[model samples]
Target chain A: MPATRYRAAPAATLSIVSLDLMRAVYHRASGRTHLVSEPVPEILAALADEPLDEVALLDRLARDYAIEGDAAALGERLEELVATGLVEQL
Target chain B: MNHVFAVRIGPVGFRVGSDWRAPIDTLADLYRDYPAPEDGIPDFSVRLFARRPWRRVLRPQVMIGGDYTIPDAAPLPLSLGLLAAEMGMNLQMALAQRRYLLLHASCIERDGRAILMTGESGAGKSTLAALMMARGWRLMGDEFALVEPETGLIYSFPRLVSLKNQSVGVVGEALRGARFGPWQRDTPKGDIRHLVPDGASIAAMAEPARAAAILFPAYGHAPDRREVAPGECFVRLTQASTNYVALGERGFDTLTRLVRDVPATAIDYPDAATACAMVEEFAA
Candidate 1:
């Protein structure tokens, strides 16, 4: 069985503003503004570089950020991002 | 049309036509200080008309219609025609204007910098802005703050300030010689009246000012104030804005810049005096 991978929309498609507590993302593709916090923005930024499965993405996030959640939490955040069209399941 | 009035407020112009003379007469008096629309051409037209010919006189009800309308909006009595006209103009701007980003907030300016106050309907923002104006701050606008997307400057709308319930008396007492419209009692939003902005505010409507800060005010609480972070400001402003979704990227860019450049605060007060003092302290 293969692990599910995900990719984010290109950097050009999103206008991201970093506020201290959260990020305000304006998705150009859908012309909608979304406010995201924590690992959601981190996941999108990590995936913007390349497609990553659950394990690879988590590894990248842990190396760069002080991540508190485990694999299941990361999976839930990815699913929510995918539903919002910010992250695509590959 | 039996009567017509034209006036320009900040960057927008309105030409109002009506079937009866009373409402137009009221508008003409209220907006007497405002200049006619540029070259006598209005950007929007508001029509206060009767549903039927006989409705004009028998039991006069002013139905608001214009460039944009709610379609199912209930008519107001002839006595409340000024409100209908004001509502008609506001509807047109809310539904059709896209040149600038519109925030449902009250704004006051001092020393070329503007302060925006936004909250829910009964948040007392309007009353606070009016009170601030009485204390020498320039009233930029009451119902809407027009933010120019290109420059991120706040243009003064400075329309008549709609005072509801206790606020009518509060502002009336504060602005001793200021002109005001008729008081209509027991309407949808309780007692209602409108106050014309000072001559200085009307004269300087075209000049835009830099936004210095954002304030979210809540009335009927013990006076307290706190700093708001950029993230919270972004969320509150998006909800406050009327044309954010319509402007898309432009709106996002402008709002981000505003949130980043200005400080935001939330103030809760039990009375207008406390709110005004707190505002003065902050502005100082």
Candidate 2:
């Protein structure tokens, strides 16, 4: 069995503006502006480069950033991004 | 289309046509201080007409139609024809205007800068703006704050301030000797009256000012003030705008700049006086 993988929309498709506590992302594909906090933006940035399954995504996050939550939390955040059409599931 | 009245507010011009003369007469009186549309041509045309010929004579109802319309909008009694005309103009701007970002907020300018107040209905922003105008702040607008997406400057709309219920009396009393439109009682919003913006606002309608700060005000609450974070301001403003989604990237870029550059605060007040005092302190 193969694990599921996810990738973010291309950087050009999103116009991300950083406000102090959150980021306002304008998704050109959906024409929706979403306000996302810390881990959500971090996850999207990580997924920008390539599609990664849960374990690899978590490993990269843990190595590269100060992630506050566990694998379950990361999974939940990824689901939210996918729901908003900011991330693609494969 | 027997009667026509045209007036320019800030950067937009509206020509209102009606089957009956009364509403156009009322609009002409209320907007007398305003100039005619640029070069005598209006940017938008609003029509107040009867659904049928007999509807114009018996139980007359004013149906709002214009460059854009809600097709299913219920007609207003001829008594509320003025409101219908105003609604028609607002509908055109809210739906069709793309030259500027339309914010459902009240604004006032002073010393070359403006303060924008936006919140849910009954937030007392209109009353606050009217009161602030009486106290010498230039009334930019009550219904909508038009922001130029390119320059980020706020233009003056300076239309008649719609005063409802108790606010009608509060502002009427404060603005003694000021021109007022006829009062219509028991309407949808309740006891509605229109207050003409002061002469200075109309005279300076063409001038634009930079936005100084943003305020989310709530009436009938214990006096409290808090600083709003930029992220919260950004979210609130997106909801406050009528054409943000339609403006696409331009809207996002302009709004982000506004939220980042301007400070935002939320003020809850027990009464108009307290709200005015808090605003004065902040503006100073």
Candidate 3:
């Protein structure tokens, strides 16, 4: 349970820009632009530093951002991030 | 709107044919400074047809057709024939141009440096760019700016600047010798007019300049400015680009280089003069 890993997908680089009201993410590998807000960016920034499994990442993010949310929901958000190649699970 | 005019603007060649003589004549007079590609055929075709067989003789409407088309697009009345032809060409370029990364931007060049301005509709990019031409900056293009993917060079397209609503009057007063097409009323974009590029822009259309900066300008605001980080600029550029996704890896690499190498800023200005001042200050 403690011996799991997750990192940004191979060859996938996230370039974030600050919009007037939101954030835009450019996925270099896909040449696609995504508009995101709030914790999505905070989460990506943290994960970009080091690989962490789902549970550990949520714990770290909750501490770093002082966020209060369901662990199951955070896990689902991590699942979506993995699907979009912004994050990975190993 | 049944004469054909072949004119080359920058890297793209266009053959515009119209069923009515008025539109073709207008295009010929406006584009008299440009020359057709002597050796090769035009890259795209713009055809203005009547809505019905008898509509040409009766009320008359100009339906834009071309090598590529947007299905169920609204038709323009014959009074707006020239605007229809221009719109058709812009549409084709937006949908089909692939050799370069097409940014939905107004580009102007000076001192071997080019600055690209883009934002949502009514951003005043076109009006400011046209005004900059009056101030001695070469107008590269108003509809789209072509960036060569391999070299990261910004090539000039220099199509006629389409000014909508109050911009038409604002630009009319700003530039004394600016050439404009017939004023169009009640079009999709209200009170439209086209301003032909000056001889300088026409002569230098083939020349390419290195991209120096990118700007996102917004009108109707108190004077303000903000620096845009490269990551944000890259993302906005992808959204502003017409064919970034279609160009594949070439688009990615070229855009990456642009955002990394050039600086980006967002400026809010109330009028063209203030906007022009903001650009000069930033580029300086």
Q: Would you estimate the TM-scores of all the predictions?
A: 0.97, 0.97, 0.84
Error of 1 at A43 (Å): 0.4
Off by over 4 Å in 2: none
Cα displacement (Å) at residue B152, model 2: 1.1
Q: Candidate 2's residue-wise lDDT over B1-284, tens digit each?
A: 79999999999999999999999999988888788999999999999999888999998988999999997899999999888988898899999889998899999999998999999989998999999999999999998998898999998898989999999889888899988889877788888888999998889999999999899999889999999999999889988888988999899998999999999999999999999999997676
Alpha-carbon error at A72 in model 3, in Å?
5.0
Estimate, for each residue in B86-147, the C-alpha lDDT of model 1 and write its tens digit. 89999888888898889999999988989999999999988999999999999999999999
What local lDDT score does residue B262 receive in model 3, on the 0 to 100 scale? 89
lDDT of 3 at B127: 92
Report the C-alpha lDDT of model 3 over B1-284, residue by residue, as the tens digit. 25899988887899998889999999898888987955659999999998888998798988999999988988888999989989999999989998999999999999889999999999989998988888889999998989998799999989889999988888888788788999888987788899998899999999999988899999999999999987788778888988888886677778777887889999999888899999887456
**lDDT (Cα) of model 2:** 0.91
Clashing pairs in 2: none
Scored against the true structure, residue B73 in model 1 reaches a CA lDDT of: 86
lDDT of 2 at A61: 83
